[model samples]
Target chain A: MDLLRFITAGSVDDGKSTLIGRLLYDSKSILADQLAALEKQSKNKEDGEIDLALLTDGLRAEREQGITIDVAYKYFSTPRRKFIIADAPGHIQYTRNMVTGASNASLIIILVDARNGVVEQTRRHSIIASLLNIPHVVVAINKMDLVDYSQDRYNNIVIDYAEIARTLGLKDVTYLPISALKGDNIVEKSTSIPWYEGPALLELLETVQLEKDIDLERGRLGVQYVIRPQSNDLDLHDYRGYAGKIASGIYRKGDKITVLPAGLTSRIKTIEVGGKEVDEAFAPQSVVVQLEDDIDISRGDLLVNGDHLPQVEQEFEVLLCWMDTKTLAAGNKYLVQLGSRTVRGLVKEIEYKVDVNTLERQPAPAQVGLNDIVKATIRTATPLPFDRYTDLSVGGGVILIDETSYVTVGACMVQ
Target chain B: MSKEHNYQLDYLDQLESEAIHILREVAGQFERPALLFSGGKDSITLVHLALKAFRPGKFPFPLVHIDTGHNFPEALDFRDALADSIGEKLIVRKVEDTIQKRQLTEPGGKFASRNALQTFTLLDTIEEFGFDACIGGARRDEEKARAKERIFSVRDEFGGWDPKRQRPELWNIYNGRIRKGENVRAFPISNWTELDIWNYIRREKIDLPSIYFSHDREVIDFEGQWVAVSPFIRLDATDVVETRRVRYRTVGDMTCTAAVESSASGIDDIIREITATRTSERGETRIDDKVSEAAMEDRKKNGYF
Candidate 1:
């Protein structure tokens, strides 16, 4: 079966959690024991109805506080495809969690309560989907039952979102009207609104196109681990090999490749996946490659096609998403882990912080705190192989870990 | 050499790459790391991936198995054989040793399981070795509370999991840094499901304990599930032992593990059976999980693997 990974982004009252719970419930994915547990924990069910929101709220703190503090991943599959949903908590301060969810998401479901139309939270989520380059956007106009299944309100909200989508450059956006609480137009088409026509929420999810979401034009592999036997015997077939997941593009035997930061060149001699010889290997497959020449290579080294080499530079512009409680100021050193390489880097300047709500650029703030996204330039102690985050999602991403705490303080996208 | 490249990935291949990536990160980041090998399919796959990650060289860390003493003999034998073949250091910490010290008590009466007692031995082993990182083969698809787990899960100095305070893991980067006394439990296969594990095992042709395949085992019908009759189990007078053609959907200590009535005698048959099965892998085999919905969560908080 095919797999689709998506994210659910909305506020507590926007029915984001309820939509996820409904998808699982209607899909027959919720097992008997889990449902029973849900029933047992739900103390204040209205008119003895099961509260679906309790299903996604896995943590005690989340249930007690009635909010999702971090991204909680949920999985379900229909006959056609498997789905991994990054259920990101919806709060202004929790924007980082949404980015975390969107990082790997192919599609993002921005739940807009029909009663409220396209609110600021809707725009904030949209901008994030654009910033992170989530390929498809499903604007589920939820709570249509509360609005008496009015198509005009849904149409107007769709119109409002269309303008924002155009402005934010959201590649693909599909609109659906439904009541997650009542299971309307979620799994099955809603007869209550005969005037509206669109694929059901679940159908859209299963078949949404992510073919072009991850680019594969330029081949790049960051050497994760090298396969070298300390003592070699003829029986061991102990040829020098480099093991890594292909970051982007395709690699085949006999292709001449360049190693970044060191610029060593060699031809691919053989390819092996899980110790079985394969003719070729492509993006994301963990394969071991042996080169024709005995070249010095190690972890933190990049292997790329000579014709499609990535930029090797010491300093560059990056969009930094601050993840730590500690404020990010100018000249604060951090360990930058980009691809397979981790090197010490300092935030040279605070360019500007984006106001996630207004989609406005806040220029040159003195310092930035938790959940802040900024565009800044950083200098590394060692050079790194670079590609713009827009070009290759896998190769261009970096995480900033605090030097003292070793905690990931920022998620940086190369610009 | 000029053949067209294929971007399509066999789903299992994607899972394998992700796992290998996580394993390398563990070896690189941790000062002292150990792979939690139970000789089960998941842990076995972990060792296989570690071989792919740091093969041709000694494993960056040792192999740790918390022996319940109620384990299937086949599992122990396979565990020993696999480690010896792989040339990795294997550390066995037994519950029997912990029980001998009177630090843990063996429960009495029917429904008593040594499964829960393994937690104490695990925490004690972690402390004894001062292992800062423990790599596990836990999959999120196994249990509910685990579904919310991060790839790089941090535990306190006492090895407690704080679900509320877990660091948000994004993209492929895992935050493995922890304080002096704390440790990180890195699950490389957290995204893999039961079917994924079986499919991977089949593709890789990895060896498993014989209990996974259908065999005639003396068992008792306990709580509506067929359970292996082990010496440590307290059987009541009403219980009847019968040899049933059964296979385990999961591998744990024989005391707490249940088997399904199946004739899936090989890896292919097991995969087919799993495709047709509706209940979860853990839901079918692990009776300990049925104590309460959050039993796994509560145990994990108390440092259970």
Candidate 2:
């Protein structure tokens, strides 16, 4: 089955957990024992009702304090696609967690409570999703039951969020009116809102085009490892194949490819997966590629089609999100993990701060603090093959590390 | 050594490759490294990937198992057999030994699980072995506290985790650094979820302990969880006894590891059941985590794996 990984974002108490619980319960995803446990916990509740939130709130403190402290991943599958949901904490303190969860998500579902049409948290999450380059932005206006499932109330939220979506360069903006508490537009269509005509949340999830969302035509193949058999058997002896997953783009046997770092050129002899040879390989495929000649290739090398090579540079500008408690100051050094390669980089300059709410770029900032978004210039110790993050997110990003502490301090999106 | 042949790789393959890359970097970055293998499916998968990463050569690091002394027999047997098959060095440290040395003690009865006590043994092992990096198969989906952890989580000399001061991890780059006597608990599978582990095992055709598959076992009711009726469990009068066909989704201390009633005798059956189950795999088995709201966070801060 095809995989569709998505991230959910909302402010605390916006019913994000409840919505997830409803989807799981309505889909018959809850096991018999799990439901029994939920029922048992509900009986002892101060308010007597099945606290559906308990299904996702697995932490003990979360149950007592009634708040999510960190991201919680939940998974479920429809026949058409298997979904992995990264349910991120919505508190301002946990903005780093939201970015981590949505970094690789194919779709981002931004939950907005209809009672409060547009809040700071909604805008923050929308900006983060857009900044992360999540292709599909789903605006789920939850708690429509409180508004009596009124189309006007739902439309107001859609319009308010639409403006933000457009500003963020989110091309695929989908608005769904869902009431997680009453099971409206979550799993089944709610007859109460007959004026609305759209597919249920599950159907939309099943039919969403995720394969096309990833740009296949534009990406460099980063070689992560070389797989060779060490034995002296006749069939397995003297084997040397460049083994690494294609970080991006497609590779054909006859295609002329350039190996970066080594600066050598060769034609693809063949592609092997689990010892079987194939004709073609694409982005994110962990296969072993054989070159026609004995080219010098090892780990941490970039392989690109000769026709389209990524920029090999030592200096680049990037939009960075500071995640560590230690602020980013000039002249600080870090270990950058870009694709399969690790290179040392120094902070050159902080250009300007991004106003998430206003979608405006403010004047140049002196330093970037925790949760600050700014454009900055970096100088790497070695040339790295990369593209603009907007075109190739997998190959164009780097995580900054504190040289002294060795912790990841921030995430950088190459411009 | 086979030639570069054509093949098709999936998402799981990509995840595995990323994990292998991290493993190689850990080996190169740290002076002395060890794998915290619990014989669980996730850790087992880590071992498999490590073998793939450094194939044609022996693994550079050894495997360590912090035995709580209150473990299922199947788990112990599986751990030894797996290590023997791979010809890799295996080190077993027991919490009971630490207690005997008067380093620590619990007020509870002998039947009480040594789950918490294992932390002392683990830290001692790290100190004794002078390991700078320890690889584990902790996934973010297991609990909320883990969800916030970095791929390379640094622990102080006291082995305490400072949540507020964790290093940031961006893209695929992992940072593994520590001062003298300080160690890092590396989780190569931090981004992987419970479903991903199972799917990888299925795709790779890796073997696991029999407990992971369904089987008939003697069990007793302990609070709301199903406890394996082993000699370690002190059953009360109200505790009902039953023989149920069940399997363990997680293998921790036998005293706290609950069993789920299942007839999933194979990987395909288990996969189907997991797909349909709404509750998380961790929720089905872990009793320690159900204790308090901040159970995982507190334990993590205290350096409990």
lDDT (0-100) at residue B216 of candidate 2?
A: 86
Number of the predicted model whose TM-score against the real structure is largest: 1
DockQ (C-alpha based) per candidate is 0.51, 0.31
Task: Return the top candidate by DockQ.
Answer: 1
TM-score for all models, in order of appearance: 0.94, 0.87
lDDT of 2 at B196: 78
After superposition, candidate 1 runs with Cα above 4 Å error? A44-48, A235-238, B1-6, B51-58, B84-88, B127-130, B240-245, B263-278
Give lDDT tens digits, candidate 2, residues A1-415.
Answer: 5677888897557988888888878987666656766787663454555777777765556666777655666766666666777777887777787888888688988899899898988999988888899989888889888988888999988888888887778999888988888899899998888987988888888888766765567547766556566767776576677766566677788888888866788888887654468887776665677888887787789888746678889999999888887777877888877866788989888888987666589986666777788899999999888888888788788888777766677888999
What DockQ does candidate 1 score?
A: 0.51
How far in Å is the alpha carbon of A103 misplaced in model 1? 1.1
* Worst 10-residue lDDT window, candidate 2 chain A: A40-49
lDDT of 1 by residue, A95-207 (tens): 88889889988899999999999888898898888888788989999999999998889989999999999999887889889999888989998888788777889888878
Candidate 1 per-residue lDDT, tens place, B188-287, comes to 9988877778888888899899988999999999878998887778788899999999988888877788899999999999988877766667777888
Question: Residue-pair clashes per candidate, as listed?
Answer: 0, 15
